[model samples]
Target: MNRRGFLIGLAAVPVITGAGVSVAASRYTPDYEPLLARLLALQGKTLQSSGSWNPSQIFQHLAQSVQGSLEGFPEHKAAWFSHTVGPLALQVFKAAGAMQHPLDQPIPGMAALDPALSVDYALGHLVATLQNFNEATGLQPHFAYGNLSKADYLAAHQLHIEQHLSQISVVA
Candidate 1:
């Protein structure tokens, strides 16, 4: 999609500010504006994760999901699940404007995140992934959500990020 088309597709996206299950400030947002802004705010901050993974891992995981939409995911849940439960799950999450999932779970076939991954690199990768997603055409099927319209996929990405970002906190 071209810039104009992407923007047009996003014209009606609802703002998801503070729509999350986490106490983390970066709340839910289907649109990129607030999520990207939150990332920018984290650029120089000291971040700690309350979850099993570190902040870098969380960022990398989020990047992988977004990247998956553009390139394709390596594995997928059973088709029945993607065709049935997956769409239902996306709808439920969208209705609440938040997502809930096991934070420690890695994407089905992806390797474990490197413990030594740099926060800066992972964070930058996520930023770039989101940017690339904006103009992405022919998005690949989601690992679980199956195929989705660009708008729905964007919502999925943002909600997924919202949930993970909740695990991270900035040091004072």
Candidate 2:
């Protein structure tokens, strides 16, 4: 193949491998001001003395679930280029996963984790995952999921967070 032809073919390989999908950067950063303001409103009012789910707990649980899913990916698959519903789901799940901790105070169940560790655990995880994804494959890189990209993951992640936020509103 001519030089230009060879380069074109080379570029096609990453696409074939599912590493060329475009992923948009995330826009839904956790807004600490609003979140903190809401939390402040609950100050001094004890969480209802029951095992009911709260936003903090829900966020933590979802974060852990995302972490677990990421951990399950085979090392070989980490860089594998493919795209499908599964990869899309994984991407969304990864975006949703965070590692935020109680930024200013100790969380009620943060006994094992240092109180200081509760600093945006979930958002931190999402950032790390984005970094990993970017390093693994540039924007629009091919993956198992067809056209699956970081942008899709971030969007899904944001949607998940918004959904949970709505749930919190209902409970509150």
Q: What TM-score do all the candidates reach, one by one?
A: 0.81, 0.31
Alpha-carbon shift of residue 60 in model 1 (angstroms): 0.6
Assess each prediction's global lDDT (C-alpha) against the native. 0.84, 0.41
Off by over 4 Å in 1: 1-29
Tens digits of per-residue lDDT for model 1, 88-154: 7787787777889999899988767976988988899899999899878889999999999898898
- Consecutive 10-residue window with the lowest summed lDDT within model 1: 17-26
List residue ranges in candidate 2 displaced over 4 A. 1-52, 65-147, 169-172
Instruction: Write model 2 residue lDDT over 1-172, tens digit each, in one string.
Output: 7999999999999675443222322323444345434434543342331224444454454444233234432222344344345454544444444422223232223223322333255335434553454344344322233343445544443444444444444224
TM-score top scorer: 1
Residue 3's lDDT within candidate 1 is 95
